[model samples]
Target: MTPLRQRHLTTAILLTLSCTIAIAKTPVATGTGGAVATISEEASRAALTILNRGGNAVDAAVAAAATLGVTDPFSCGVGGGGFMVLYLAKDKRVITIDHRETAPMSFQPAVFLDNGKEMDFETVVASGMSVGVPGTVRGWHEALQRYGTMSFRDVLAPAIGVADKGFTVSENFTHLVDQNTAKFSRFPATAALYLRNGKAIRAGTLLRNPDLARTYQTLARGGVKAFYQGPLARAIVDAVNRPATAPGMTVRGGAMTLADLANYEARIRQPVHSTYRGYDLYGMPLPSSGGVAVFEALNILEGWDLKSLPRDRAEHLYLEASRLAFADRNAYLADPEYVDAPIAGLLSKGYAAQRRALVDETRAASGPVAAGDPYPFQQDASVPLRPAAVKLQQEGAHTTHLTVSDKDGNIVSYTFTIESWGGSGIVVPGHGFLLNNEMTDFDFTGPQPNVPEAGKRPRSSMAPTIALKDGKPAFSIGSPGGATIITTVLQTIVNYVDLGMRMDQAVDAPRLSERNGTATDIEPGFATGAQAGTLARYGQRWSDAPEEIGAANALVFNPDGTVTAVSEGHRHGIGSALVQKSAH
Candidate 1:
């Protein structure tokens, strides 16, 4: 058999074994060699396969991310951008890679405006003008080149096979497509791939993307330059400049050029750091609101003896802390180079202590809370403070997260996105990939900090995080839920570190997200498992979450010298947790 057929056979065997193992394992895997956790079994398998082949954490993570692009395309892919937080075991330090998509030079403050008002999200989301310069491909290349053991070609092989041979369509995938059927039909390329004979493809049917497979091959052979400078880049620019919209559809085209695509570069940045009960938390820095926001929340929670509080009491505090942190997040966090975000002040314990004083364990704060001033805590005393007026809007809660580790102990926690599901509703004609609508993440109506501007990356809540104990990676955790991502990570960490829950329990525990909104959004199970009645006495208001709060994946380095991989059990369907060697 040919190499492609061999990979297909291998994948089939792996799928059968993975199903059997997953059925017995309960979305939790324990082993010694390595561990991988993700929202898709195929993605987990891809990363595990790499780990079994001696690829390090970076290599496995890149492989997992590439496979997620194929299996979880609506949420994240080569067309989008993301943040990767890595724990370098040998160096005993944490670092981050920021590849958040950038607005084109031609974009201006009024780009999303019409007749002096911000255009409706629906009116702009499906248009080419919403597409940002894609950074996923370059970002992947950068990680692999700098830290991975395998070449890009080698690492991409599994995803290419899956795309060529096809994987089974999932129920969640079908539902997401159903929601976007009308919007997707407006683009011929998008319609051709997602719809079968002009209708949504049913779950369990095999789906293939030969075009994407070929595109991956092109990148494998020509490297990142092929994606940024050659035919693929031209095709992307063409699609953005003048999309292949179906007849009767009308939308504005983008101003992105080959130069914009060519100039896109991923940055290696410092990870935001903090301490929670002696454990050090490291996460993506500026350009993402997740890291600092989560750090700030954790610092506030540090003042409470959550380990001694009742479930409702501790959870109420978590909700209040999140509210305060988001208040600051909306006001001060953005792309650091563009916005002089008081990063030092925001992460300072003094700032958190002052903010924490606003929390009342007995009564919840009312309304959208105002942002706090962190300028006093700034290390640079002479730096002026920006006004802390608050105005906020929600972002699409669709994205993907994955975690991976190798035998050498390096860990990677990554979160990636394309803004909304079925991003831009335009697949690159023949390239078989969607372009990111990340530009829509910009605050269309905002202060100077986060407003649309040339080369500015819109603020993100994609917090990929790692927690260290005694200068070693104790665990890695992350999730995908737009603004709720910070709360998800914070709650999970709190559940594990403070409440003494196992890794699986920490991830599966009921979640609550209060982004300084008027009412707290609760997962359906939030009340059932906790002291449900008394929470309202604390003046906690409730709004039912449309579905679940977050589908998170995590890895725990047990003191016993074993690694535990955990994923969601039911949210967005059962996620997959894979280990090279299963404990059972």
Candidate 2:
């Protein structure tokens, strides 16, 4: 359900304006031919339109992601970057693409420090120091060049149309806008685009971005180089270094040279591979902690017969496993270019067994738990053991996700984001897009795994996963919630694979996020469930989440060869799940 703060207005005019959009934001669809699932109906339509035009899953994914830049601007756009996990049907191989944002080459570890003291987080978030060089446009270019069946112009047409013609703003958009009013109002470009007379637009208002459409057209005409090497690049750099602030509003500028943009490239990386109950799973590799952390936790849980256990007992184990995995993740994982993550050791079942031994089913472990040593399992006993404890860091919950599949069995699971709502709060003048605040994702304090460095990608928790049952596509799932993303994906897979719940049931089930914290964050449904009291007796402390944990989209391949696409029934204003044709 939409949060109480986002309750829709009861007025004939507003309802009519919202209904006029024509596309229904249906939360679930199971059908034949092809399928697309995302948080917005406009984006779903964009993907379906591509599928109908003979584009492959890779093409459809790019289309949906671009459309989301228009419909869900607060979360993602060309101004951001992300990870993509794709399955090529013809090749029968699952590969991952890493297009995550990178720190500028001139960036230093002490960027957020003053007189050896860390700056206030809120101030740093809106300054130029927070911006990361974006990798989205190049990432899309790579995906299309590698596997797509259509031209960039063809896939981009849908998003351009959506941007030129507006969609009715929903309660979710209004809520996000209201939440970021102070930030948005600081810049003339951002303010003029989102606000009306210096105020947030109401739900059902028509929101258009001709500037973004024109920007898309520019890319269509000049190609990716136009964005990375020319006027667009200059405009982006100017916006970062000399932020356009409202009179009397002061914000720090950042140092981002055109060299940073031109030097950017999306790389093809090996997917993080593991197995559960005979199912082969693939996830995005480092720079992203999602795949490794999920694997470690699942390996720990695999020791138990969760299917036969009672609900409370099983959930207690789930929380403990997540806590332990996060402890390891915080201490060890970061940008692979800068740190040699112990990939071999972290995913080893023997290491998981060691971690699992510490979990007492009867009582929750006190946190922050010390990160375990996996060097022995890595067969590199000479490597020094890691520091015992690490601080818990939280990332922006403002990211977007989508999943797509073609009739040919190709699939793409993607998650992308601008660092925070309104990002650095500066929009590129003439061209329209937010610059990412992703630099702030790094640790401000010293001697940590995720501290910022030149050309290093910050650690991310986006786990876009594809699983194989008998070496065929079984399911593709992902979500958008900072650190909670790992737990959401892990818990959903557990719900479907271990608990035997339907795909939709797994997506809808109440969420609990345990990141080696003193208390796990729980959704209202979980806190109110009958088993909540029983779990508490096991020493599982609960803290109600301010908003739902994750907005997720998924698809399951059935035994009969049909695909089931599922989205949240209510979270983030009812996500859209659609297929090329209805099952009935």
Candidate 3:
């Protein structure tokens, strides 16, 4: 949620009014056909290049995903991890893949604690303890092996070319590098790879990753094994376990071992899907609060007279729904393997009505709202909180997401992350990027329930979603903000379905979210200045002072069989939508 302080309201209001525009504050790409999609602009261009030459959606998606790995490396790449949701029209079915990172075998709970305290979040985030088993490779390869029509090598050729020739660094890359300059400087290898002669790489500068290119080559030949079981894995283990360059510190370095990578496997699982206003909404299951919370919010809002509310009132609804969803998330959401996530009870209309009754129309309810006793599926009767030893880092804008739907009616929405900015700033030798400090994404101390443990997945905010309206694909979208992803996406959907807006209008619409106990908005003009008093009245506390809530990219299908797409107005990620004339 937004981090606007009371004093900042004056600035937020001024910025919001001045920046509000008929056009999206960010660049958006729109097009049309029966098959519609929004992907990275560069990736979209590359995919279109492949499509015009006869590639299908799967082919285009592969190409787009690969290209994005190079251009949007800060958020995603071969080094990081993500999940993919594929809807294959030919089969008339949906498939979900869990390539999320795994905790290393050496990962133990006590390491992250500080004398029984958990304040060393900096150490957890920077040291080997924070790393998890990387999964992007396995996930991407599985999709290709199971359903893709094109050769893996062929699909990745464009990325290989870009990496080899060295594409000019985009503004987004430059900005992230500048933002995380300190973290990047902490490690010699990281400093050597990203920084140029001790200076940050600027936009338009040609950046090459010969090492990454080589890794990609290995993938082109060996598929997922190139990373999971080969030299790269060895390098990762060595890098994490090696001692820091600094003098004798009690903590040697990292704890990750080769066994972690060698034994790690990406699981193919069923998506946590539910029907929302006739649309089949499919999202990641456990470990991600996206699917369940999003469903809960939408289901609850469905009961309200949303259309009758004024714009701000609608915003209030967004805030309320967000609050309810986050409450459930903090209280019960977790890996299904570890805990029985109250998915059914949370999404049930009957249950939502009970929860909705607790919301005050005029102000936010103070403290957490009880989930109205318990539904049939909800079993554990308890309030959950991360102890003082546990610290929750606000969602980091350190990831990238893409949506690709092919002419064959195959749709894929993928979200990937390195956690935050180059992730721990520790690079493996011969690997272009650093390992993800995803362990920091989890609660590190305090309550035993929140402590890091072997085989438990950390909770994530990545929400790559697809909507099927009237039993057909309507829109596919997702974003890269921690808790805010759920809210931004919900708003976009409501704008189209309820507000009678066109594709562009719906996507470019202003956004608000209250997930994680705060109502937030990008003070329109400032894009970073946030206001929380409106939500504060509802009992949500403001903290972290949001710089950016979430960045969303979306695609909408026109009744005339056209398409419109948009990217976050405040940042620099390309968004594109395309339509095919026929199912060629």
Predicted structure with the largest lDDT when compared to the true one: 2
Stretches > 4 Å off in candidate 3:
1-40, 243-252, 367-373, 377-393, 446-450, 518-544, 573-584
Candidate 3 structure quality by residue, lDDT tens digits, 1-584: 13343224323322332333333222444444323233355565556555654556666666777777776766667666787888888888787887888777766667676677765666566666677788887777788778776555656666666667677776767878887776666677777778876668988898887777677777766777778786888888887777243223333366677777777777787888877667888887777878888888888788877778765566567677777777777666666666656577787888777777777777665544443333453554655332222123444557767776665667778787878767766777666767787777666653434346786777777778888888787888887766667777777777876666765676666556655443344534433334344444445444444455556666665566655555655445445544444322
Taking every candidate in turn, the Cα RMSD to the unseen true structure, in Å, is: 3.1, 6.6, 10.2
**For each candidate, what TM-score against the reference?**
0.95, 0.95, 0.86
Q: What is the lDDT of residue 218 in candidate 3?
A: 77
* Residue 396's lDDT in candidate 2: 84
> In candidate 1, where is summed lDDT lowest over 10 consecutive residues?
16-25
Better of 1 and 3 by TM-score: 1
Task: Give the TM-score ranking, best first.
Answer: 2, 1, 3
Q: Per-residue lDDT for 301-374 in model 2, tens only? A: 99999999987889899999999999999999999988888989999999999999999988888666888988
Tens digits of per-residue lDDT for model 1, 458-483: 99998899988887779999999888
Write the number of the candidate with greater TM-score, choosing between 2 and 3.
2
Candidate with better lDDT, 1 vs 3:
1
Residue-pair clashes per prediction, in order, are: 0, 0, 7
